[model samples]
Target: MNREGINVDPQGRVAIVLVRARNPLNIGAAARAMSNFGFDDLRVVNDYDVPFAEARSAIDAAPVLAAARQFGSVADAIADCTLVFGTTALGDRRLQHPVELLRDAGPHAQAARMAGGTVAILFGSEKTGLSAEEMSHCHRLLTIPMHRGGVSMNLGQAVAVCLYELARDGAAPRTLPEEARPATAAELARYETLLREVLVTSEYDRRFPGNMGEDALRRLVRRLALQGDDVEVWLGMLRQVLWKLRQ
Candidate 1:
């Protein structure tokens, strides 16, 4: 069963975790940026070459990325984090109910300063954005304001904005235990199977048909490293609308 209540753990190294990111260069770039800000706790949750790209992007900080761990599932990456934040572009959508600001999150950091727990801030893929499932992993959602409408920043840019806010100096950690567990590969794969079937049966693939062959397509979905909760949210939507016929 899922954990009963909300528990926050303050006092730990904040992990700048990326889930299903698209580009190696961007991973390298984010890795470099994190190190610049004194954050070496980088975790890439994807079934791809996270370490390689981090090393390449390290430029001078290549070692930071090189030492970065690649997790096949999000759960493994965040097994120890006491708190988790998910970054989103949907400003004020109430994306994660009762979300906290980067400024407000400082308290938790302050609390954790000595408690020595960990925080994981998750970022999404580049081509589109974070998957519906990925967004659900976070205890709180962090969104950066932009002037222009429909404005979307690259993965590296998004990571930089978030890092500047939470991990920057003069912030305090929280006092709590931990967060919802990350999902297993078996759970994530079930959701992928659902999406894959949706692609095949739903009209999306046929209408905007592209080169999403099984293998290539699997890579795209797998990169997200979605959890069981994430999968359920997407499946719910597909069942309710996307798979339904227009009236």
Candidate 2:
């Protein structure tokens, strides 16, 4: 894929992927990162798109926020792309390409651009990171070199690193497709309400009493990075479960 306009600053195409994220703050942080580095395309796969707005992040990047895309599967997110990469801290194991240095990735990205195909970098959930199944879709793997003995990166930081790397060098800047919009702050709020109703009806409150932490639970639901259809399925399941519980 090595040719021209690949991985250079302000001249290359870019896309972001969030897989099963469980924190809205991280999503907000990512939006801010996009604004800071001039990247707008973001792909999410979860039962609920992360409610980044409620956390008070990604202030000016609202345009990017509005354009975030929802996907039912990772395959859908990176399907048409000419190349795909996954980020991880677990690349010490044997794989086609272990975590490569940003320097190395630069050349690879440019090559893909030369080949004329969309390129994407994938990320996973905060809890367990990307699964082997997800990683299989990537052509390369990048592991941000963390400080010695440092904890793995929070969602925002990881995104900032990638966006910065791609934009700092001036990857060809461009607008993302309609398919790249993430969930808005308002949509997330509605999903949060639905999530709470589901939980409340399912007797989750009885298990925790009056201090059931509805707000916190709502926040948890808001941060999950789910797409519209994904949310529908989750709510349906919750409804069915709650219906049975009431019986």
lDDT of 1 by residue, 1-247 (tens): 1133324322137887888876778888887777655567788888766544554555465566867888887778888888777767774444644566556766665565446777788888776466667776667776676765666887787777666665445322333566656667776667667776666675677776674576777678767766656777877876665457433
In model 1, the Cα lDDT at residue 234 comes to: 76
Whose lDDT is greatest here? 2
lDDT of 1: 0.68
List the candidates' TM-scores in order.
0.56, 0.60
lDDT, candidate 2, 49-124, per-residue tens: 4453343345454666678887889999897788788888863555665568665686677667667767798989
The weakest ten consecutive residues by lDDT in model 1 span 1-10
Worst 10 residues of 2 by lDDT: 1-10
Which residue runs does candidate 2 get wrong by more than 4 Å? 1-12, 49-61, 91-96, 171-247
| Among all candidates shown, the one with the greatest TM-score | 2
